[model samples]
Target: MEHSMYPSMTKELAKQRSDATPEIQAAFKAFSAKVFADGALPKKTKQLIAVAVAHVTQCPYCIRGHTELAMREGATEQEIMEAVWVAAEMRAGGAYAHSSLALDTVNQVKSRSGA
Candidate 1:
């Protein structure tokens, strides 16, 4: 059955991209490995961060991949939930931070209109 919207298309596209540019693919793979490796932060912590970032980015593929990776790396459900909450807070904070731009624009418009 040829499904138009195959769920595995993410993997297939990644494979195709890697096949088309092995060097770039290798570099990315190496970089990702180094980033996720245990150093100051534990692997489980890194995976939890990734899961949180995936949630913030709203990437379904990344969310699934990192959630599974976090689980495999021994992140508990509570920890994952906390990470998600952190992401939520950060996402909202970003919008709140950008509200300064809106305030500035409003002030400029008021000044121009002598309001």
Candidate 2:
């Protein structure tokens, strides 16, 4: 079996982590429950958003967990794929937008060389 730098997320590991900090764990659980609860946005919508954000954040665990959750919350495969595309666009857009830094350096170098 290939071992990864990131350990597999198991319920036992989760319990061990939570056992180390029960109070914080409870608080985090409450926060997660509240965040996932239906509000102005339905659970399905939230899960889709989570899926997109997870992709952008590059968290494999979150991608799997939230993809499952999104499905459970009635998000279709098409919708989940759309969300991934959205994330891809946003991630690419960020790099595209930040290319201004390279442009700035180019202009600066050109000015210094009087070219």
Clashing pairs in 2: none
Assess every candidate by TM-score. 0.87, 0.93
Candidate 1 local lDDT, 3-33, one digit each (tens): 6543665778888989999999899999999
Off by over 4 Å in 2: none
User: Which candidate leads the pack in TM-score?
Assistant: 2
Which residue pairs show backbone clashes in model 1? none
lDDT of 2 at 43: 97
TM-score of 2: 0.93
Model 1 residue 95 distance off true place after TM-score fit, in angstroms: 0.8
Provide the lDDT at 1 for model 2: 96
Per-candidate count of clashing residue pairs (backbone under 3 Å): 0, 0
lDDT of 2 by residue, 1-115 (tens): 9998889988999999999999999999999999999999999999999999999999999999999999999999999999999999999999999999999999999999998
lDDT of 1: 0.93
